[model samples]
Target: MKYDGGAQNVLSEDYYNLVIDQSGNKTAQGVINVANDMTISNSASFLTSTNTIDVSEQQRWRNLNW
Candidate 1:
């Protein structure tokens, strides 16, 4: 918090943006959003020489509730 009160409470992240103007105006934007969907991700890469390349990918998911 600083003495200058031009704009307060501002936050910006990788996929989202937020701003609060001096007149109590708020602006928000998000590039990515996921709602009511199960999210999963997997990736694979090769780590062999130019002559030989080996790539493998596997995924395992487990959900437990009590």
Candidate 2:
């Protein structure tokens, strides 16, 4: 997953529960997990490699007043 240029809020006082997971594979397999109030930005690459099996999971909330 890639986050461009933007503001992200993983946790807020009015919300609860946030989790993120990133995985990749080359000759071997690898994984990454982030929990609670995490933000990624600026063309970030979650899992990158030559033979990467790139994978990611994220959960969050946003308020839209319309």
Candidate 3:
């Protein structure tokens, strides 16, 4: 998914798995927090490229039930 120029996408701490296959410029003009077990596979064309992310906070959180 493309994190447009002004949108801050937050994947909050939850009990699940997230898998994403994206292409083009996945630029996070704002914060983009990808939680645990998130498998992000970019396209072959953008495979050698890196995403620009602005992390406002930590990506992972401790499970209280554990």
Compute each candidate's TM-score over C-alphas. 0.15, 0.23, 0.29
Instruction: Give residue 22's lDDT in candidate 1 (0 to 100).
Output: 31
Number of the predicted model whose lDDT against the real structure is largest: 3
Candidates 1 and 3 compared: the better one by lDDT is 3
Residue-by-residue lDDT tens digits, candidate 3, 1-66: 322232233333332433334444333233334444434454411121243332234443322221
When superposed on Cα atoms, how far off is each prediction in RMSD? 18.9, 12.2, 10.5
lDDT of 1 at 14: 29
Please give the distance, in angstroms, between residue 36's alpha carbon in candidate 3 and its true position after superposition: 1.7
- Which runs of model 2 end up more than 4 angstroms from their true locations? 1-29, 48-66
Q: How many steric clashes does model 1 contain?
A: 0
lDDT per residue as tens, model 1, 1-66: 111133232222221211121333222222222222211112211111223211122322211211
Better of 2 and 3 by TM-score: 3
- Candidate 2: which pairs clash? none
Quote model 1's TM-score: 0.15
Q: Report the C-alpha displacement of residue 64, candidate 2, in angstroms.
A: 16
- Which clashing pairs does model 1 show? none
Badly placed stretches (over 4 Å) of model 1 are 1-12, 15-21, 31-66
Predicted model with the maximum TM-score: 3
lDDT of 2 by residue, 1-66 (tens): 222323332222222332222222112123233343433323332332333222234543221211
How good is model 2 by TM-score? 0.23
Kindly give the number of clashing pairs for every candidate: 0, 0, 0
